[model samples]
Target: MDLRHLLAHEVAAGIIATGIEGAYDSVSCSTAGNYPSMGVSQWEGGRGDNLLSWIDGGRKFIGRTYSDIVNSGELDELRAALDSEQGRAAQLEILAADCLDYVDALMPYLNDSKCVIYAAMWCPTSTNVVRVFVRNRKSWGYDVNNLSALADVFADEYYKAAAVGAMYRQGYSNRAYNTYNYLVTHEIAWELLDA
Candidate 1:
C-alpha cells in the first residue's frame, strides 16, 4: 500500500475522531444506544472489550459486560485505563488498522483520494451503505471512473442519508458538507495522490 494512502486514512480518521470521539481518552456509555463506547472510533460492545484487552491483555476490563462495569462504578476505572499512554497508543493503532482495511475494501470500487477518505469516514458507521453506493454508481447514472463526480455524489448521498434520520440526524448533513469542504479547501487530492 502507498504510504500516502495510509496518511490519507490517518487524516480522515483524525477528522472523524475530532467530531465524534472528542479526544483519544474520551468514553461514553449508552449515549447513542445501550452499549459502552470508547476511543476515537467509539468501539462498542465486543469491540470495546477488544480495545480494553489490547490495552492490558484483557487484565483491566475483560469478562465484564457494559452493565457489569456501570453497575459496579467501574466506568471511571475504564476511562483511566484508556487515558493512559499505552491506551492512547492502542487506540491510534487500532483506528489506523481499521481505516487501512476500509481503504483496501474501497479501492476496487473507488480509487479517488477524496472519495476514499469520505468512504473511510463513513464506513465505520455504515459499511454496506457506502459500499453499495460505490458499487451502484453506474446504475445511479454516475460515471464510476469520474473521481470528482464520484466524490460529489458520495457527499450528496451522505447529506441525504443524514437528513433521512437513517444514520444520523439532519445536523449530520453538516458533517458531510464540512468534510467535503475541508477536503476541497485543503486540496487533499493534490496533496495525497496528485490527482
Candidate 2:
C-alpha cells in the first residue's frame, strides 16, 4: 500500500474518532492513565509534541527531497529562467512534480507496520495535512479521485482504532487510577507495543 494511503486512512480514522460535530480539526484530551494525551490520538510527549513532530516531519521530508532535486541540478536550469510569469509557472510545476516524486520515493519503505508506529510517534500532522489538503482541494474544484481511495482507507483504520480503544477501556477505567500507577503496571505492555 502507498504511504499516502496509509497516512490518509490514519488521519481519517483520527478525525472520525475525535471529530466534534464535523469539525475536522477538533482537538481532544485523553484520560488514559498510562498514556494521557491530547489531540486526535491522545498523543503524548507534552504540549502537543506529537502534532508538532508530524509537522516537522513534513517539513523535513520536503526539505530533504527538494535538496536532492536542487543538488542534482534538476531544478537549477528551470529556476534560472524564472524572470517571466511563464517561466515562474514552469519552475513551480517542476517543483511540484519533484516533490510528488519525493513522496513516491518514500512509499516503498512506508509499506510496513512500522509506518503506523512512526506516525503515532513522529508524523501525525503530515497525515492530517493530507486529509485537510484533499478536502480543501475538492472544495476548490480540484479533482481528488485519487485521494478518495485513501479516505476509504481512513475509515477502515478509524474503526480499527476505535475497537482497540474500546477494548482497552473496558479492562480499566482511566479515571479510576493514577497515570503513574498505570504506567508502572503497564510498563511491559508499553514496551511490547513501543518496541
Candidate 3:
C-alpha cells in the first residue's frame, strides 16, 4: 500500500486516458514546439526550457523523499545490499526508512502548472477541470490566469466532436477519458484512502 504504487496507477490511468503518447510522438523533444510532451503528465518540453525542467521536477520528488539515504554517503553499502541475495527485503527496509508517504507528498505535484494544464486538457468533465483549477489556485499557490478560458476550449472541443457522433461509436476512443476520471476518483482515490 505504498503511496507510490497508488499514484503510479493513477498516473497510468492518466496516460491511457490522454493519448498523450500520441501527442509526444508527434512533437519533437529536441525542438521547441507546441505539441508532444513527456509522460502521463504531458509536461510540454516544447515550451521554453521546460523539457528538461519537467524531467528535473519528477527527479526532484525522488531526491526530496530519499535525500537522507542518498546523502548519507552510503551508496556503496546500499548498492551492495541491493546486489545481495536478500536484496528485495533490504531494499524495502531502506526505502521504508527513508521515504515518506509519497501519495500525500504527491498532492502538490497534482496541482503543478503542467499537471493542471494536462488535466484541463484531457479531463472529459468540466467539473473536474474546475476542481483542478481551484486546487491550483487555492492550494498549489498558482495564479491561474486564463485556465477557465482554456477549460472552456477543452469543453467546446469535446462537445463538438460528441455532437457529431465522431468517436463515440468506438467506445474505447478518447471517451476513455470518462473511464480515466472514474478510475482516478474511485479506484485510485480509494487506494489513497480518499474515497
Best by TM-score: 1
lDDT of 1 by residue, 1-195 (tens): 475456545554545544644466666664656667776778877778788888873356765666777888887888888878888788777777777767776777765666667666667766666677677775677865564575566555664543464555434556656666665666443454533
Task: Give Cα-based local distance difference scores for all models.
Answer: 0.65, 0.33, 0.37
Clash number by candidate, in order: 0, 1, 0
TM-score of 2: 0.20
**lDDT over C-alpha atoms for residue 152 of model 3:** 36
Q: Which residue ranges in model 3 land beyond 4 Å of their true spot?
A: 1-13, 16-42, 45-48, 54-121, 124-157, 161-174, 177-191
Candidate 1 has a TM-score of 0.73
- lDDT of prediction 2: 0.33
Error of 2 at 40 (Å): 9.3
Instruction: Report the C-alpha lDDT of model 2 over 1-109, residue by residue, as the tens digit.
Output: 4444444443333333333112212222234333223223333334334233334221222222333534665443323232234433332333233234333433433
Q: What is the lDDT of residue 111 in candidate 2?
A: 34
Task: Determine which window of 10 residues in candidate 3 has minimal summed lDDT.
Answer: 56-65
| Candidate 3 RMSD to the correct structure | 14.3
Candidate 3 global CA lDDT score:
0.37
Better of 1 and 2 by lDDT: 1
lDDT of 1 at 12: 49
Candidate topping lDDT: 1
